[model samples]
Target: MTTANFVDRPATAPIGEDLRGRVAFVTGGTRGIGAAISRSLAWQGATVAAGYGSHTAHAEQFRADLAGELQGHAECSVHQGNVGLPDDCRRTINEVIEQHGRLDILINNAGINIDKIVLKMSDDDWMKVLAVNLSGAFFLTQAALKHMVERGSGRIVYVSSLAGEIGNIGQANYASSKSGLFGLTKTVAREAAFQLERAGKLTDTGLGITVNTVTPGYVATEMLASVPEKVIDKVKSSIPLRRLGRPDEIARVVHFLASDASSYITGQVWGVNGGIDM
Candidate 1:
């Protein structure tokens, strides 16, 4: 092609094709799975903005790490906020969109684990888990849905756990919130599909937005790093891969889902577990 033609090429023309010109916001994206997602998106040509409650140091460090990988590829930044509050979620995501002019992807990855039995679990326990895990996602998605609905494009993924599906000991509240998110995904898909079908917008048929979930199993991170050695050994022994999953592994899936390649998928739960759970 001529030089002028090349200059006029599409955004993903020079680089690889994954998520070019898209903007994404990730919650609880500092150093673990969320950071991985942020980095992956940046590498794929998506301008990524990550939100964190505290630990500004960690968030900035992640930004620096991604900045190196996405040089001349894409852009990324970190925002500080609490994902559990509707106002906080609104402020964080809206500001990003207001600045970027659009938000094409959202990863509600912040979650908490308050392990306790149902009988012994206080109301606060139940509410706290739900607030951060389920309610937080709800709030962000709620605000972003307007943009996605209006633009007829968006991708949203919730970072869940196998415990959300199979139910683990001392995680009744957590499981409940994660499971509830599944319903939210399905419900949004159903509603958005109905609107598009009625309007006959075949081009935007994937719910005007693709909503999905990613369930990870036994990831080895600083959070899990605190566990006793024996417990870690036992957990790793049960994995078919004989090891815990890395952050980048999960980030890879997030990249695929955020990209156009996963357009046909929605309202489904994908497991990043090492072949242990379906």
Candidate 2:
């Protein structure tokens, strides 16, 4: 190709794609990895609806941060709802569509970890983890699928964990929920592809709406604060990189999946575990 034909673009182009007018919904978007994902999407020009369950103060602070950091490059609004509840999921999805006029991306990042040995775990603990981590993703995706299928394009990225891939001690409930998301991601990818084909919207590569998962290893977040420092040190030692993955590192992968660069990619799990899974 001629030099003139090869247009050199800056490495930082907002969102790596021209998502100037898209709409995205991120669950648990007020903190940690979800916050990074929300900011990344917003920076790329998508109007973001950040969903949070509790943590009103944290959520409000996140909104303020976005307002200051984004500087009107994009819009981000906070919505309160528990993804575990079907009613809340439905209502939240409806609210996003009503406000933004469309929904293009759905990030199932809301999750809770209740670490307890299987023998000692309570029914409430197991159920709560699964409901929030696994079922919530399904409920939200189901609610958003209608709009995506009608529009014939969408992106769904589930936030899984390395614990799900390689089971962690005293995290049976959390592991199961994260593993369940793998199945959910693949199934949804196939179904959405079928729908797009039926609608005569499939690309030449037979691709349409994409569904994927991102598995992150240890990260320095409030969630990790619950872990004993000694345990974290042990984890760091185990990792080949001898470090924890950053939320933004995981968000970068999510951004790629959310962008047009990953148009032909679906039903995949991108791990950001700093060689821990190797």
Candidate 1 lDDT for residue 89: 89
lDDT (CA) for every model shown?
0.80, 0.86
**RMSD of each predicted structure:** 8.3, 7.3
Which pairs clash inside model 1? none
TM-score of each predicted structure versus truth: 0.89, 0.92
Off by over 4 Å in 1: 1-15, 198-200, 204-208
Q: Put down candidate 2 lDDT per residue, 14-72, tens digits, no spaces.
A: 53335678899999987888888888888888899999999899899888888787777
251 in model 2: Cα distance from truth in Å?
Answer: 0.5
Please give the clash total of every predicted structure, in order: 0, 0
Off by over 4 Å in 2: 1-17, 205-207, 226-228
- Candidate 1 lDDT, 7-57, residue by residue in tens: 122223234647889999988876677877777777678888988889888
Worst ten in a row by lDDT for model 1: 1-10
